[model samples]
Target: MSGGLVALLDDIATLAKVTASSIDDVAANAVKASSKAVGVVIDDTAVTPQYVSGLSPSRELPIIGKIARGSLINKLFIILPIALLLTWLAPHFLPFLLVVGGAYLCFEGGEKVLEKLGWLPGHHEDHEEAGATSAEELEKSIVSSATRTDLILSAEIMLVSMAGLSNEHGVMRVAVLIGVAFFMTFFVYGLVALLVKADDVGLRLARGALEPEDNRPGPVDNIGRTIVRVMPHVFSVIGVVGTVAMLWVGGHLVIANLAEVGVPVFHHVLEAAEHAVSGAGGFVTWLVETLLSGVFGVILGAVIAWLVVGASALVRRVRARA
Candidate 1:
């Protein structure tokens, strides 16, 4: 009886070790996969803040919260399952889907450029100027728009993550995907919440720091005043950065995808640029690649914008007659 009990105990210890090893593998895989999606993660962060801009001080945090919630749902409930199915059943379709996503990024980046150049018009600036809108109405519009945008970005992120992972068992794939989804939503939206509340935080600090004399400034008040002064510049910088990111990332995606499908032109051009710099070529190489990518992104974006606008007008005309 004692001999039998010893053998059973030894078996249980081996099982425990196996389980621990499996958990470690899952964690390592999750991290690896998540890192691949970093570009889309950056894009997500860049794009989200714009949705909350131009809202009143009190509505800012609440609007961010709503969008954050929607983003979470998009990743977990919607994107994760679809990603798993795509990976499992239609792995071959992944690259094509990524190209479609790349085209979308290019189109969006192009539209922004046109709007900036006064060739196209978007309602975003006008909406910001139309003040005193009800919080509920604003919240609904912002959340809906944010969620729709999130879906595309989330799809890109998921595809990147999927491409990074090994063709593992179904269980492991699902686990890694779920892990990536949760991590991205938490990281992106947490930063957004902080960004949207920054001005309000500054205001509160300024108001609380009452001067001992009516004419004197308190430390908190001074700090708040500084923040208020800087807020406009900060937001302007964010907007500029977001637009640049869209162009760079979208261009990079298209170039990379083209290279993946055996297009040698972009790769060879980048290689030539790298070689031209000789010993200190790394910086030059990076600059060349970025500039080329931005150019491609802008061109692609413009073509897409033209098509979409023409299509929309045609549709409207057809509907009016019908």
Candidate 2:
């Protein structure tokens, strides 16, 4: 009886050790997977703040919170199930879906470029144009647009994460994917929340400095004013970076998917460029590839934009005639 009890205790210890190892493995894999999607995550973070632009300072965090919740829902409920289904039933379709999403990113990024160049109509609908009769309506519109955009970005992040964990098993894979999703949403939105409120924080500090010891501007007051002044430029830089990232990632997707589908010429060209630039430096090779990808993305995006715009015009004409 004593020996049997000792054996049972040993077995329990063994099981506990195995469980602990499994949890550690899951965490390591999730971090690895999440790192693979860093570029998309950066794009997600940069793009989100634009949605809250021109909104009341008080509403910024709330709007960000709502979008983060929607992003969570998109990853866990919509993207996860669809990704698993496709992985199981029609794995080939995953690349196609990725390409489609890439094209969308390209279209959006390219349209912004054209708008800046005065070649395309502006897409941004500011608060006045919204004709929002109530705060709720305006918030709803902003949240809806943000959520829609978040869905695509979140899908890309999840798909990228899954691709890295292709070798992982059933329950482990799901757990890691969920971990990545939650971690990314929280990180991105949390950073965005801080960014959007930075100006407000600065303003408060500036006021506080003035309220205290001396009514005259001090070093602290100067620092606070500097922050408030710097935020707009910071946001503009973020916007530009986000647009460029979208273009690069979109084009990289196209090139990669094309290679997977057996057209390898572009990949070969990039490889050759890497080889040629090896004598120079790794950074040069990366820069060459990135520039090439951005160019491809811009061209693809322009073509798609033309088709979509033409189609819309045709539909408008048809409705007018009817």
Question: Which candidate number maximizes TM-score?
Answer: 2
Of the candidates shown, which would achieve the greatest lDDT relative to the real structure? 2
Model 1 per-residue lDDT at 151: 86
In candidate 1, stretches whose alpha carbon ends up further than 4 angstroms from where it belongs are 1-32, 35-39, 53-59, 125-141, 166-170, 262-264, 275-283, 320-322
Question: Using Cα atoms with residue i matched to residue i, what is each candidate's TM-score against the true structure?
Answer: 0.80, 0.88
Query: Which lDDT values do the candidates have, in the order given?
Result: 0.76, 0.85
78-168 per-residue lDDT for model 2 (tens digits): 9999999988899777777777777877887788787898877776546543556788988888888889988988988888788778688
Residue 222 displacement in candidate 1 (angstroms):
1.6
Candidate 2 — number of clashing residue pairs?
0
Extract clashing residue pairs from model 2. Answer: none
Model 2 misplaced regions, further than 4 Å: 1-16, 127-132, 211-214
Predicted candidate 2, C-alpha RMSD: 2.6
